[model samples]
Target: MYLGSQEMRTVLERDNGTIQKNLKKLTFYYGASDLWCPVQYYEDIKKDFPSGDIRLCKKGIQHAFVTSLTSSREMAAMIRDWLKDDLAEM
Candidate 1:
């Protein structure tokens, strides 16, 4: 999902408890360098959902996966390989 600045602000608010609770999983494709949410955010989120699954995909760029990835073929191949590991428990 493409989250705009306004939407992110809404999600970060404590009053949006229902929305926050429903977001059990978070996937970040950082492209290896882009620290979008920062390390402290990751640490804080982990503390809240200690056992929740957080998927991170680091590709061939520094925080520019969405823009730098020239071919979807490589991404598809990577995903297929990653899913084979059976990450259902995490």
Candidate 2:
């Protein structure tokens, strides 16, 4: 399957009030060396949306993390942990 080499879509902007209202509830995770998204993209979004939970993978995982069983397991566990608190309150 083709992955990480396509051009990005056009940018979309919403009202500041709407963005701020939903920012805190969103979680954005990017691969440390993802080819699909450059570091600049992460930085830009982080600077624009400081209130959101934006995280970069520090485990050296790449864009195709699903190709590796170990990475898949680690990523899945990390996501589970991230959502554990929310699940508990549900």
Candidate 3:
């Protein structure tokens, strides 16, 4: 069950062209902080999908924000708001 670098890249890397082609039909809300995963990844995604909702937490929230009840609630609220706004547009 251990996937090495190539396997991981194959599983994770998206074809930018394909994603761009379908971008109009997709709704995304991506959040990333500099604490765990690289902030540049999210930035790149924002660049690729300019219309997509992406939140970069400069305050350095941990990657495992859901481990605490308070953080989980905050995350849920954020998602709920995003969902509401997305639904309103459709």
Candidate 4:
């Protein structure tokens, strides 16, 4: 499901503000490498949600970083730690 540039622009302009406002109440984890989605996208999202956990892998992992068993385990562990910390604060 891909939206064209114009469609995406319209959707973002209409909805991004609401999304950004609501993000303050949620904990977000975003991981991106130099491989698939450009690091800039993550950076932009980080700007939108300063409290989010935005991790950028300088090693340039593939888009499917979690497909490998080891990578999946590591990802799971990272999320587990984040959730623990988040829950602890509540």
User: Highest TM-score: which candidate?
Assistant: 2
Q: List the residue pairs that clash in candidate 1.
A: 33-63, 34-63
Give the Å error, residue 5, model 1: 4.5
**lDDT of the candidates, in the order given:** 0.52, 0.77, 0.67, 0.62
Clashing pairs in 3: none
RMSD of 2: 3.5
Q: Which residue runs does candidate 1 get wrong by more than 4 Å?
A: 1-11, 14-35, 55-61, 70-75, 87-90
Candidate 1, poorest ten consecutive residues by summed lDDT = 25-34
State the TM-score for model 4.
0.61
lDDT of 1 by residue, 3-43 (tens): 66768777664333552666554343323334565656555
Error of 1 at 57 (Å): 6.1
- Measured on C-alpha atoms, candidate 1 has an lDDT of 0.52
* Model 3 superposed RMSD (Cα): 3.5
How do these models rank on lDDT, best leading? 2, 3, 4, 1
Clash pairs, candidate 2, are none
Model 2 off-target regions past 4 Å?
1-21, 88-90
What tens digits encode model 2's per-residue C-alpha lDDT throughout 1-90?
A: 233223223334434586678886788888778876788777877898887788877889878779999989998998899899768978
Give the best candidate by lDDT: 2
**For model 4, which pairs clash?**
none
Please identify which of the two predictions, 1 or 2, would achieve the higher TM-score against the true structure: 2
Model 3, TM vs. native: 0.63
